[model samples]
Each structure stands twice: as structure tokens, then as C-alpha cells.
Target: MSGQRWDMGKDTLSTLAKKTGGNTQDLGGLVKRLAAAAQPLEGKLQGAGHDAFIAFKGRVDSIANDLNAGLAAIAKGQSGMDAATRTGESDMAQAAKKAEGAANFDGAKFTKR
Candidate 1:
């Protein structure tokens, strides 16, 4: 009878020890479930980031294109203005030469003398 009681005590203690010892498979399963639960949120965040990146890239491209076009317009305007100024200067120089030729050597024909 004492032997049977001793065996029962040993069995109870062994069962308790085995229960307290953590199982690797259970822990792994729990980790997998937690990861699975977070997958949707991760995917959503990725999608949002991708959308924002595309929008930002498009905006930057648009701004760059507009800036280039504006610069080209400014260059064309400056070129036109430079051509006009050159033409005006040439005309003024020709008029001055003609006036100088019309004047006499002593500057008395057209002047008061």
C-alpha cells in the first residue's frame, strides 16, 4: 500500500513539472497567429505609402515641367528684347551719321555760326 502511494505522488509531481514546462510548438503557433493578425495592417500601410509616393512624384514632375516652361518663356522674351534694343541702336547710329554728314566743315551751314 505504501509503495502504491509513493508511485502516485511521483506521478503527480511529474505531471505538474511537464505542465509548467513551455511547449515550443504552442509558442510558435501563438507567434504565427499574432503575425497573421498584423498582416492586414502592414499591407494597408504599404499601400498608403505607395499611393503617397506616386502622388508626390507626380506633383514634383508637374512643378519641374512648369518651371522649365517658364524659364523658356523668359529666355525667349529676353532674346526678343535684346534684338529690339540692337535694332534701335543701329537706327540711332545711322541717323547720327547722316546728320553729321549734312553739317559743314566749319559747322556754320546748319548752326548759328
Candidate 2:
């Protein structure tokens, strides 16, 4: 059983080395190559992140513009409402004065000279 285990371990190591295309001692070289390959990807990721930030900023600006437009519309509507209310109040006051004048004329006619 021990001999079989030893043979199995050796076979496993050799198979692993063959599959990896190199010996285990070449791990450092493989890591360096992998790092070299990853550097360009890292730069690309940074550029993508920058682009995403710009897009996000553009969206924020658009939202801010929309909010400003909404506020301006609200202000205009409020001014219109205020003007209408003032006009209505003026009309009511004029009507009250006319009614008062009519009442005074009626009272004067009912009284003696």
C-alpha cells in the first residue's frame, strides 16, 4: 500500500507539471507573466471607471437642470395664481362699493326730505 501511494504521488506531480507546461519551480516566472498581462487590463479598467464617472456626472447635471426648470415653472405658476387672486379681490371690492351706493339711494328715498 505504501509503495502504491508513493508511485501515485509521483505520477500526480509529473502529470501536474506536464499539464502546466512547466515544473512547479517556474511558478515565479508564470506569476510575472500574468502580472504583465494584467497591467494593460488594469489601465483599461481605470479608463472605463473614468468614463463611467463622466457619464454619471452628466446624468447628475441633467437632473439638476430638470429640477431648475421645474422650480422655474413652479415660480411662474405661483405668480399667475397670485395675480389672479389679486384681480379677484379687486373685482369683489368694486362690487361691494356699487351695492353700498344702491343701498344708500334706497334709504334716502324712504326717508323724508
Candidate 3:
């Protein structure tokens, strides 16, 4: 009666949440390290070069911010799925049994499953 299914458990959700948090922290640390490592070189650049570098760093930081937000959303959804599993949400449980790959996800329409 099914072609495919997706299954997840509390342990998987918990581990994913933990890993996502760690990744967020690591990303922040990496950004900080990049800033620290670049401080020494900023002085070497002059005028346009320094301005360009600054803009690039700003863009990178912005992308990282977006990435962190997406990760957080995914982690939150995972937790919701876990809750649904625990509380016996039939729809969520049924969907879990037939979930398929999403071609596009913006993390903007996330709802408690």
C-alpha cells in the first residue's frame, strides 16, 4: 500500500538537534576565527581592496546567518515531529510512513507536524 516511507525516532531527533546546535556554534567560531585571521591582513589592503574585503566578509556573515536560521528551523521541525510521534498524532504518523523527498523547501512554511 506504500511506495516509500520516512521514519524517525526520538533518539534521531535529539541527536540531530544536538548536532545542529554544535554546527551553529562551530560556524560562529569559524567566523570569529576568520575575522581574527583577517585582522592581520586588513592592514595590508588599502582603499578599494580593503573596502572589497569588508563587503565580502559582510556577505559571508549574512549567508551564515541565513544558514543558521534554516538549520534552527529544521531542528525545530524535527522536535515537532518527535512530539507528534509521542502524542500519537495520526496524520503526522501516517505522513511519516509515506514521506518523500521534497524538491524545494524554504523553511518558511514550517508547521508543527
Candidate 4:
């Protein structure tokens, strides 16, 4: 048996982090387009015997508004996640640099003077 271990959680996290921004934008755009397309249908349903149709159109408008709000919330959450990820990456790099510097300093101090 080959000694290869697969870490699925790490791979999933990396893929999600890479795609979060693009996916969020695409979803937001689709929601906005859906909302826009629904707007004209509201006007087209204006007739005397179409009360139910009018009511349904109103409900559709409400749903579109809610979807847009949800999209905004998703975007805000993605922004926060991106900032946190960048900060985490920077902290890890800084820690690695400090550890490397300390390792070199200790070697030099032990061998010289």
C-alpha cells in the first residue's frame, strides 16, 4: 500500500474559498435579472377580471424584493469571509517567517562567539 493520505475537508475548504466571490456575484446577478423580468409582467396582468392574477403579481414582487435582500446579505457575508481569510493567511505567513528567523538566529548564536 502506498502511504498517501487524502484530506477531503482541506480540499473542500480550498475550493470553496477560491469560488466564493465568483459564485456570490453570479447568484446576485441572476436574482437581479429575475426581479427585472418580473417587473414587466406586473403591468401586463392589468385587467378587470384578473384580480387573482394581480394579487399573484404582487406576491411575485414581494418575493423578488426578498430575494434581492437575500442576495445583498450573501454578498456582505462573503465580503466578511474574504477579509477574515486574508487576515488568517497573513498571520500564518508572519508566523512562519518569525519561526524561520528564530531558527537561523539560534543556529548562529550557538556556533559563533
> Which segments of candidate 1 are over 4 A away from where they belong?
1-54, 107-113
Q: Over the stretch 39-111, how does candidate 2's per-residue lDDT look in tens digits?
A: 4554456577766654544465455455555545555565565566667778999999998877856555665
User: For this target, which candidate reaches the highest TM-score against the unseen true structure?
Assistant: 3
Weakest 10 consecutive residues of candidate 2 by summed lDDT: 16-25
Which candidate has the highest lDDT of all? 3
In model 2, state the lDDT of residue 40. 58
Each candidate's root-mean-square deviation in Å?
Answer: 39.2, 34.3, 16.3, 8.4
lDDT of 3: 0.70
Query: At residue 50, what lDDT does model 1 achieve?
Result: 62
Better of 2 and 3 by TM-score: 3
Q: Which ranking of candidates, highest lDDT first?
A: 3, 4, 1, 2
lDDT of 1 at 73: 56
What TM-score should be assigned to candidate 1? 0.45
After superposition of all CA atoms, the RMSD between model 2 and the true structure is 34.3
Clashing residue pairs found in predicted model 2: none
Tens digit of lDDT per residue, candidate 4, span 9-84?
A: 3243445545663465566566556656776666676576367655654566456556656656665675566677
lDDT scores for all predictions?
0.55, 0.54, 0.70, 0.60
